[model samples]
Target: MLAYRMRHRIQFQRRVQTQDPNTGEIIVSWETVLFSGRLDVPAEVLTGPGRELIAADAQQAETTARINCRWFPVDRLELYTWRILWDGRIFNITSAETDRTARQEWRLRCSDGLTDGQ
Candidate 1:
């Protein structure tokens, strides 16, 4: 892979659930940083009629992004539970894939949960 392609800086976060001792309430938090890396591939915004269809069916706008990182344990990632921060935008990890044999790179597919707004 071209190193120059990984120009966008991105951060991965995982949600953590904690209980308030006194209030007896469950707190949803995402303070855990699973990984901090660069995305060589730029993000692609979904638009036009296809985007409308996705919004109608999924109820949210989805943008696709590919993130590249060095080989790391795949267990560190939890699909659908991890969020990505890039350029002040938040994206949810839709899928992650890597070649077990190569074990040199990680490709992440992400979706920004919005239709028109970033």
Candidate 2:
């Protein structure tokens, strides 16, 4: 793994839901920092076929990033409840997978069009 290539710093945030003190209303917040480290975010390029597939589904485009496990040790549970913050942008993680042969890195499929407002 090219550790030097992980130049883009990113923050992993987990959504937490809690009840209000007096109002007794459930509030959503993202104050937990699960991990903070450098990542490699390459520009996404969709081919003709790939574009067609997305168009058919009416799905918004997404950006994928690769993170080194040495820098950020993320587990499966965290993957489902965490989102990434990079360069003032919020990215919702669609999937997180590690290589079967070498679990030193994690590929995160993310989307910028969606937010954790719900």
User: How much does candidate 2 score in TM-score?
Assistant: 0.65
Stretches of candidate 1 off by over 4 Å are 32-50, 53-60, 76-80, 100-102, 114-118
Estimated TM-score per prediction?
Answer: 0.68, 0.65
The clash count for each model shown is 3, 0
Per-residue CA lDDT of model 2 for 1-118, tens digit only, reads 5666666656667788899999999998886463333343322221122122254568755444434443246577677677766777676776777766545666666666434322
Tens-digit lDDT track of model 1 for 54-118: 54466554556666655566574454577767777787766777757658777666666572222
| lDDT at residue 104 of model 2 (Cα atoms) | 60
Worst 10 residues of 2 by lDDT: 44-53
lDDT of 2: 0.57
Against the true structure, whose lDDT is highest? 1
